[model samples]
Target: MALLNKYVGITTSDGQSHDGFIAHVDQDYITLAIPTNEMYGQMNGMPAREATYRQFGFFPGFFPRRRFFPRRIPFGAVTGLFLLPFFI
Candidate 1:
């Protein structure tokens, strides 16, 4: 359970890679906190835009803000699991 709550990368049997925080783990599956970039306006089919705050010194460059949603992956389908460095 050392990987719990840690951001990590996962490769599945189908050869697809996924990145997320290890939210929960159990006997059969592992849940990942998948990051999504959905905001107030974006959900309404409007073009997503980042609001920059020069006074607050907040510049969302390459990595924009993210919200996490849980996704469950069965252990049987996992081909690889590794740790990754994540910063907000």
Candidate 2:
């Protein structure tokens, strides 16, 4: 699923909202790298800051960083599937 590598937003039947990139998908559920808003804060009022290599800490000469734990939404528990647009 090409969408697996792109950002996605999903709403569940329980009335909760989650936003992230699809990390894995199967007959059961979809894994999303939902940002840890509590840990990262809302990032509001920080317009000059954007998601980039440096945002998560990067080093061209030393290491390339990537380690994320995405949330899961069971296929049956999903109430909506939003595509191509972001509200987060």
Candidate 3:
């Protein structure tokens, strides 16, 4: 399974927590489609309020709650995969 598929929660710097599916991910950002209206604001394209990936927590498998693991695939690997078709 994809690494992004395992993440379940996003904890903001302010201590707010949001639960949702990850809609998009980039080197510095993650888009979370949270269920609650309060958390929905993060999806808005406001530059001052965007959430960072440091806020996210992933569940490795069938776990019911979120957990944190800091290590991630390097950015170069992701870029290579994304650009592979062009080189092919």
Candidate 4:
């Protein structure tokens, strides 16, 4: 999947609206990195933040499915029939 760089508006636990750039995403979470002002004493702590799985929206597309490989061949005897002709 492609990494996206976009602004997202999120409502915090305190019922505040925060807008920030999305830094990374996973199956269950998103990381938002917000820039701080120089006047805020250099913003000592981490700038990036995280949100829950349900906070974001998705665009319409197909999701990938698990790959399955057949374990048993119905006719093991016929396998040689299909390959033997190629060798001859």
42-81 per-residue lDDT for model 2 (tens digits): 3433434444535555322223323456687899989887
* Model 4 lDDT tens row, 2-86: 4344544555444444445556666655555554432432323322333321233211122222232212112221212111111
How much does candidate 4 score in TM-score? 0.35
Higher-scoring candidate on TM-score, 1 or 3: 1
lDDT of 4: 0.36
**Clash tally, candidates in order:** 0, 0, 0, 0
Cα misplacement distance, residue 33 of candidate 1 (Å)? 0.3
Top-TM-score candidate index:
1
Candidates' RMSD to native: 6.6, 10.1, 17.6, 25.3
Q: What ranking emerges by lDDT with the best candidate at the front?
A: 1, 2, 3, 4
Report the error of model 1 at residue 52, Å. 27
lDDT at position 5, candidate 1? 94
Total backbone clashes of candidate 2, pairs 3 or more residues apart or in separate chains = 0
What is candidate 3's TM-score against the reference? 0.34
Candidate 2's TM-score reads 0.57
Quote each prediction's TM-score.
Answer: 0.67, 0.57, 0.34, 0.35
